[model samples]
Target: MWRYEKRLQYPVNISQTNPKLAQFIISQYGGPDGESAASMRYLSQRYAMPYDKGKAILTDIGTEELAHWEIIAAIVHQLTRNLTPQEIEESGFGPYYIDHTTGIWPQAAGGIPFNACEFQSKGDPITDLFEDLAAEQKARTTYDNILRMVKDHDVCDPIRFLREREIVHFQRFGEALRDVQDHLDSRNFYAFNPAFDPGQKPCGCKKNQ
Candidate 1:
């Protein structure tokens, strides 16, 4: 159902190798608020989204998150490529190197392996969209942290692109949240679960009420 694209969503061409930088950058690959978590969260939540617009937004953003994941992987790959053992030890990548030499694995900066616990997929559309918005902001903050520690233009350029995307996605999710809110009864947004309580009217009160 998905088409293959031979190109990266944003091109990454790093001329220098820095295992230290790679260590931090790898967090975005499998860390909390990372692209992998974002993709899975949105894609999984889409099935419960009641509105077509919400579903579409989730689908589009989820796909885009996958693209961002690939970007992060590429950055990590380039940064660790051609690393010498001496360079790895000096760069403080020795612990990581011992486990997987120059091989890209999904782990947080602290070496926590990627896990679903990093994100949530509540069946409630409101909760999920809010989580999406928060996820984007968290990702943006992570990128800012990376930018502060890194000076290489080759690395910073792509990181900046990814950060800007987080902003855009945050905006889109905000709009999606507003759309869902508008469909709910003004009296009580939580009166009913729109996704599960199909027989209830859009603005109707709770079934028990």
Candidate 2:
């Protein structure tokens, strides 16, 4: 039930080709804290969330993560476009070029392919929300690392936008975690899985009540 926008969440227009920079940036495309993992994690966890507010938060943020993925992919594609054999060899992109010449593939800077093991959907709302919060921070740090190596204004602009989004998502997830915590007994928040074990009544501690 999603519609095509025909536009990126953030525009990417890189005038210079830097295969080395592309190698580093590609990590965010499929790295552990990458957009693909973030989107999948939140979208999958939403199904087991116990509250409507939590579910909505996960759903909206998950969708936004997909858009972020598109932005990252565009950056990588633009960075690697119109490369020459000499540029590939000089820029040390041969290893990647041999595998997928100038093509966008999900892999870490070291060439580890994207894997589902990077994220978890624990089904427990608290656990999943906490994971979401951590994921955003991890992504932000990754962007920080990228900004340190990149000097292109065009490249940095969209990346900074993505980095800022990580902060905003982290805040939203913090709020969602608080909302979930409010429903559980503070003394024993882990007493039961809110997404399951329906018969176990909440402890109704003073803090939660």
Candidate 3:
């Protein structure tokens, strides 16, 4: 159960319309590394999470990813709103306009419709968490690419916010992974961590240094 908030997590007021830019940003809405996949991946994986910390973080981040999706949607909407016929054709938005007509639809910039294959929900917590870490980085990289192309402060500011959240989410997931590992029994299958951090105490979750 979620408490419905009528406000965006971060405010987005894009005064100028840029259909070309919207075409690229729309990928974050439904692309492989997009928030839509992140939300679904984490939420679905929580069911198989053996650790409470893992479950909690997954739910928290999953809900937040939904908010990120809305943010992306709002950005895309604002950029494409009030499009003229010539702007649509020149921006190469005609195909999408034919289908969505400025409405939000789940598809990559290349027009690949979002699908379940975009994410994973493996029952293994370690595997899923590792997958999540990679996902966050991928999203951050996508945001970095967007920031490079975006010239408008109004557009890049909110995108920067989203990018920062990706980095934060990556950190949070890292903490949750360490927590889950720390709490595991020696006899557990995942107890033998092949990827254990070097130059760190084996009992690694307690220190800040």
Q: List runs of model 3 lying over 4 Å from the truth.
A: 185-209
| lDDT tens per residue, model 2, 86-150 | 99999999999999998889999889999999999997999898899999999999999999999
State residue 172's C-alpha deviation in candidate 2, in Å: 0.2
Quantify all predictions' global Cα lDDT against the true fold. Answer: 0.93, 0.92, 0.89
Q: What is the lDDT of residue 52 in candidate 1?
A: 89
- The 10-residue segment with the lowest total lDDT in model 2: 199-208
User: Candidate 1 lDDT, tens digit per residue, 1-209?
Assistant: 68979999999999999999999999999999799999999999999999989999999999999999999999999999988888998999999999998888999999999999999988889889989999999999999999999999999999999999999999999999999988897787776778988536457556685
Clashing pairs in 2: none
Which residue ranges in model 2 land beyond 4 Å of their true spot?
A: 199-209
What tens-digit string does per-residue lDDT give for candidate 3 at 1-209?
Answer: 88879989999999999998999999999999998999999999998777777889999999999999999999999999888999999989899999989999989988999998999987767888999999999999999999999999999999999999999999999998887677655466365332353223456466578
For model 3 the TM-score comes to: 0.88
lDDT of model 3, residue 186 = 44
